[model samples]
Target: MSHVANIMLSVDPDDRPTVESLSRWLQTSAPLRGHGPGATGRVGPLGGTTGEDTRRGDGGFPERDVYAGALDHADLDELIAHVERLAWRQPEFVHLFVTDQEQSSFRVWRFHGPKLRQISPEGREEEVRPAGGPPDIHTRFALAGDVELLRDMVVAAVNWGPGPAAPREAVLSDPRNAHYVDGWPRPGDLGLVALATREVDRWEPAPVGAAWLRHFTEDDPGYGFVGDDVPELSIGVDAAQRGRGTGTALIRRLLRTAREAGIERVSLSVGRDNPAVGLYTREGFRLHGRDEGEDSLTMVVHLR
Candidate 1:
């Protein structure tokens, strides 16, 4: 009978000590980190571990090491491929290690994930798994008090990744669902409020005035502007309360107000690079234009 064994190993410059210790430990237990006859291993550039020969040096620093033995060649090959893919996706260079106890099967793999780049002194960027390419924005109206719930609803609208699916119907059916309608801030709804700031003098407050004051005490304190005429969609969510449809619910409620007001359009602005663009786009908002001075995109939705 053939024996099966599997292990996962990773090395990262970001995790210097851990990688070094793991490499040394694997070496001591078995001849997995160094070269020898009868022992199987592979080494190459971060992404080139899929071919037959494992020993093509690339003259690169932090080369990945894979040690394998005592397994059908096919299984070992698959393991190497999987590890290499994972490594290539990591932000920093990484090496993978695997070991099999029963038949003494072991292997190592390496790859470098997307690298981080600095776009400006204050801005840095990293590649994210594409979420359905560019996002599509939709607009909806919501009530003032239901802002929290609406945000959650919007988040539930899109499948962020392969986790448990969110409860779409339940999110939509809730009477509190806000962003489902158009022309937010119905005739008598409270105006959205802006947190008092030095910039307060820069823009005039809505003539109808703000009814309720809500401040997002997250990384940034965002003010909500609720009123009968002004658009009142919530932006950002509580760090702990995000990803459960709060943003969607908030937008839906605002849309409901808009529809009631007989308003056929609603709009908001977000920084071009804001992650919230994904959620806004999914909710039916679209980029109508851009504000170059502010580096913001003016997104709008038209209601029928």
Candidate 2:
């Protein structure tokens, strides 16, 4: 059975970029079927494969429309020839966005670092799997409200590299540990927990944990404080979830969130012992400074 992914877009009436346009924002250009002459760049309005309107918001200012379409199943070799083949692209995610809508834009979230299986409203499943994709799993997201949950994540992030178990009981007592979840859901604070419900009766969490950012003033800066304008990033997944490319998904989603929030960059501090440093490097974090006598490194990801 085919499962459909829905995409919503806000577009201006003129020269809007759509799936049909094949604008290739991050990926390069390729021949696409849905584009036509004299048609504004949007789904149905252009040509070829198009999206059906599930919901249409008022046409007044920032007109928004809900669109649902089938998952493209072009073979990976052919797909990669035209696009960069991002790690976050997956079988279950709807990667559609208003590629270049004039005067308006929406944040596009990547939900499929590990290709996920979807249960449609009609209960059908997406049958095609990408050639080298990860095992199919059901994905979930939630707010990091519970401090206990935040604490577990805190321990994970602090002890990221391969080594002895870092003390969890008194982890938060240290100023360094407190920096990550200290303000715990402060105003403008954002967090997203990753969960999977494939193997167990309930959602098993921490596979690729949450990515969080907190902005602090000079009066009280976190250990990784870059500036008042840049949010500091703290992320850690359970030991069970390491090395599966799940961390990449979490970081990209956090980057999307930061972009949506108008943040220019996000920063973090990590030690030399951490293996996960490569993950941040792959996601575009640059070394900004060193902490703790060269034992730790400070990094930042520019959103703008």
Candidate 3:
């Protein structure tokens, strides 16, 4: 079988040097790193089919130009790092897609946005490290100690309160709050956390994010609660580490955890104003309904 990585690189009109330098680098380096053809392989973008025109000016990005092409999975990250070094600003627009065409699937390694495959260039394959890389985190089961960690993540979820978040004390005040995080990681409750370190992980050496499910009941439904079987999800990334791909990593890991646990579906409630809605949508969560308050929307993802 064949596995191809189709990348879409874009930047604003009056772009920065990181972008210009990236264009220059790709012009020279892609040829060196790419395989199978002269330029990009046959899957190059032709028209609007590849989401080339999907531009949103919400996050401070005004306009964008796309660099779309397909390459072997091996060359994907080098191209992505070129985009990521420009992303520290968390600008409104910077998008990329690394797609596997065989499954009609693609993962946005950066959309100003959000990794895998090594970062080796053609010859000195082992020398270079991943650029704009995945956070140095490992996924692990939620331990009993995660209660405190979950408390912080809950605050992190709502931009750390003083505004949109619910009272922190209330979220973890009682056992009835189990749907969210009061008594997290219950019997059927599967959770995964992203652990990192200051010295090695580029951040604090601690658990920074988590994704877990709690099967809710008819009388005690979660905010995004659907039913008893469809466990509601509560996921949050560290406030200090929002834009650097930690959220994406945690979700991907939790999805794998869900599949292994024989889970059939998961649900979550997200606010319309949350930036994470983009991340959740990208990771396959879809709309179910809006809350009575209308400030939030319920989303669900079916696991296979």
Candidate 4:
């Protein structure tokens, strides 16, 4: 199959050195073309599709540019190497995400002068890694020792977003949401934390995501609660660590744990527009119901 790379760069409009450097790289290095100001809807880097107009302002930056093209395997390698070299020389201003057509490969190299590191799905930065391998992503049963960690993850999970995030205080203050972590591991609470292994400078594994089950009384049912015997689910994954299958892994493992513990089903309430809706569906969750005027979905998966 043909290989293609879609590269997006967020750059300051006034930074002539970086601009010229990018122009020169496109002109001399690979099969890709740089599309910036006035370069609207031109041929996409991956070809066929129209390119997104990057001339418009984005996230406080006046402009961002895209470089895309189909390349032979060798040329794709050279292009990636070229980007790494540029980042090595100018790490401060280099913010890039490069991925292939199939999205089976991605690169967002972290550079420290001459040194280069890759951010694994688990969030650790490792030096000079290869393109593809099973991610170091793994999970462990959360313990009583992780009370503080779970509390922090509760916030992380609630505030997780690719769009507007609710204020932390607002999320925690809600009675419906507060029950997830308020009691500090109630009698039936069980959870697993997805860890990315370790940080570049620290020895402890960093928590990137979490999934847990908790029982609710019929009088105070969770938003997704179906019955007093069914445990409601709560999950959150780090914003940076998402889209790499960490959430899926967490859900699959957590469901297995629920089944092993003699639980027959688990349920969760999620916003309709959340990206994870597709993920939940793929993992066997089916819509249970939705309350009137509510924008969220109540979904359930049978573990029996």
Can you write out model 3's per-residue Cα lDDT over 240-275, one digit (the tens) per residue? 777888777677767756876799888988887787
Number of residue pairs clashing in candidate 4, backbone atoms closer than 3 angstroms, sequence gap of 3 or more or interchain? 3
Better of 1 and 3 by TM-score: 3
Order the candidates by lDDT, highest first — what do you get? Answer: 4, 3, 2, 1
**Worst-scoring 10-residue span by lDDT in model 2:** 121-130
Q: Name the lDDT of candidate 2.
A: 0.51
lDDT of each: 0.38, 0.51, 0.60, 0.62
Candidate 1 local accuracy as lDDT? 0.38
Model 2 stretches with alpha carbons more than 4 Å out: 1-144, 201-208, 290-293
| lDDT digits (tens) for residues 5-56 of candidate 2 | 2334223223233433433421233222222222222222213232344333
RMSD of each: 20.7, 13.7, 18.0, 18.2
- TM-score per candidate, chains pooled: 0.27, 0.54, 0.52, 0.53
Q: Kindly state the number of residue pairs that clash in model 1.
A: 64
Please count the clashing residue pairs in each candidate, in the order shown.
64, 0, 6, 3
Q: Rank the candidates by TM-score, best first.
A: 2, 4, 3, 1
> Number of clashes in model 3?
6
Which model, 3 or 4, shows the larger lDDT? 4
lDDT of 1 by residue, 1-304 (tens): 2222354444333444443443343333322211233454332112222234643477344444333233222233344443343323333445444443222223333332342222221221101101222111111222454444444534443323346755866644554333332234344443221111112223111111111212222332222222234343434343433454545544554454466657666666565666768877887887775456665566766665
lDDT of 4: 0.62
Task: Please report how far candidate 3 places residue 100 from its true position, in Å.
Answer: 31
Relative to the true structure, candidate 1 reaches a TM of: 0.27
